[model samples]
Target: MSDHRWSPRSPVAALARFVGVPFDAQTYRNLAYLLLAFPLGIAYFTVVTTGLSTGLGLLVTFAGVPIVLATLVVTLGISSFERRLADHLLDVEVDGDDGGIELAFGSVEEAIGTTKRVLTAPAAWTGLLLVGLKFVYGVVAFTALVTAFAVSATLLAAPALYDAPGVTYTFGPYVVDTLGEAVAGGGLGVLLVLVSLHVTNGVARFGGFLTDALLGGAARSAEAADA
Candidate 1:
């Protein structure tokens, strides 16, 4: 009788299949953008909320007019920065529609028109809303990423430290103390670490998709081909 069994060609091949993130470069690039989201989200939320509040609170005062105007101007600058960031990092073409916001350069008239446009454009406010909510996404991503990495690290290191003093491993009610148990736990750890990498990559891709939707406008909608 012949034995029938299936196994991976090699350890590296197994890991590669498990960490099935397409295009390693793209994955890393997405990860880079996701990593920046946390800090950027914080700054965006702080500045925009504070500026809007101050402007509204002081609306009755003579000083309120200029402050409100200045706040809008500052937000226009922030919107420009975000546009550049989305374009460069996500590689999404943000073609504007009627409600789209854009900054023009030329005469003083053009500059004033740009300022007026920024103040009136609905997309500008929409972008601000997106920015304000981005901190929540950042928090969730940061927490998930950190937790996955920590779990992977702890699992991988469990075997080596199992024999060390004051070291204990427990699964439910059973304690892991024997060498056999340690070996089995280590093997499981290796598999989970690969899975964790995939999870991290997935989070990055989701973040990119969301930002693309928020900023890409019609260009993003262009994904659906004509019948």
Candidate 2:
């Protein structure tokens, strides 16, 4: 109880938070980040993977060094964008902090030097891996969030539609043909929606961790700034 990491401030408070769901600011912010993750994931996967493969292929001919460097530079830039996204949306620090992410290469010479550093950096590779994984998780998360919301909306509206002729909704082989059943379904919908908020929070935490581990902590913040 004393340690928030080990347990919630209070069991009751945790339950209340679960019930309150995504109505609050943090949850909404998490939801927004989740929605954006899919597209960003797609972009990350496409660019990084392409750059890696292209650079690797050209390596044999000595033509690949530049491509590899370019890829690293691009990924580094993308990582910076991801850091900004996490800092802005997720509950984390990315730039202008003790351990933050700030990658800005201004000159050709600077880019060349930065690229060399980025290639050998484990954080850069790890960050690329995280970016690739984000696409997969983002798809699943987006679907779940949308499904939860849709179900909640439909069930909440059931009672209003119950009086309509030939109106009936089925839930797991249970037909909601009466006002009472409709209302009950609506209540269930509410519960599911609340649960989904926690899911959104979990996903946001993951994104934040990835940003912190890979894109953050100022690898070249000072150098890039001076560049």
Give the whole-model CA lDDT for all candidates, comma-separated.
Answer: 0.66, 0.73
Off by over 4 Å in 2: 1-15, 94-115, 216-227
The runs of at least 3 residues in candidate 1 whose Cα sits more than 4 Å from the true structure, single-residue gaps closed, are: 1-17, 20-23, 96-115, 170-174, 218-227
Candidate 1: Cα lDDT at 17? 68
- How well does candidate 2 score on lDDT at residue 115? 62
Question: What is the C-alpha lDDT profile of model 1 across 1-227, one tens digit per residue?
Answer: 53323246666666566666544665666666677788888887888778778878898885665566666656555555666665676665454453245567588788677768767654465567677768897778777778876766766776888788876777547677888887887787777766766776777666656655665552344343322
Q: Write the per-residue lDDT of candidate 2 for residues 1-227, one digit (tens) a residue.
A: 37654366678777767776756898888888999988888888888889889989989998888777777667666766677778788868764332233344798777666666666554566566776778887788778888888878887777778668776666656777887888887787778777777877987898787677655544445447569
Provide TM-scores for the models: 0.71, 0.76
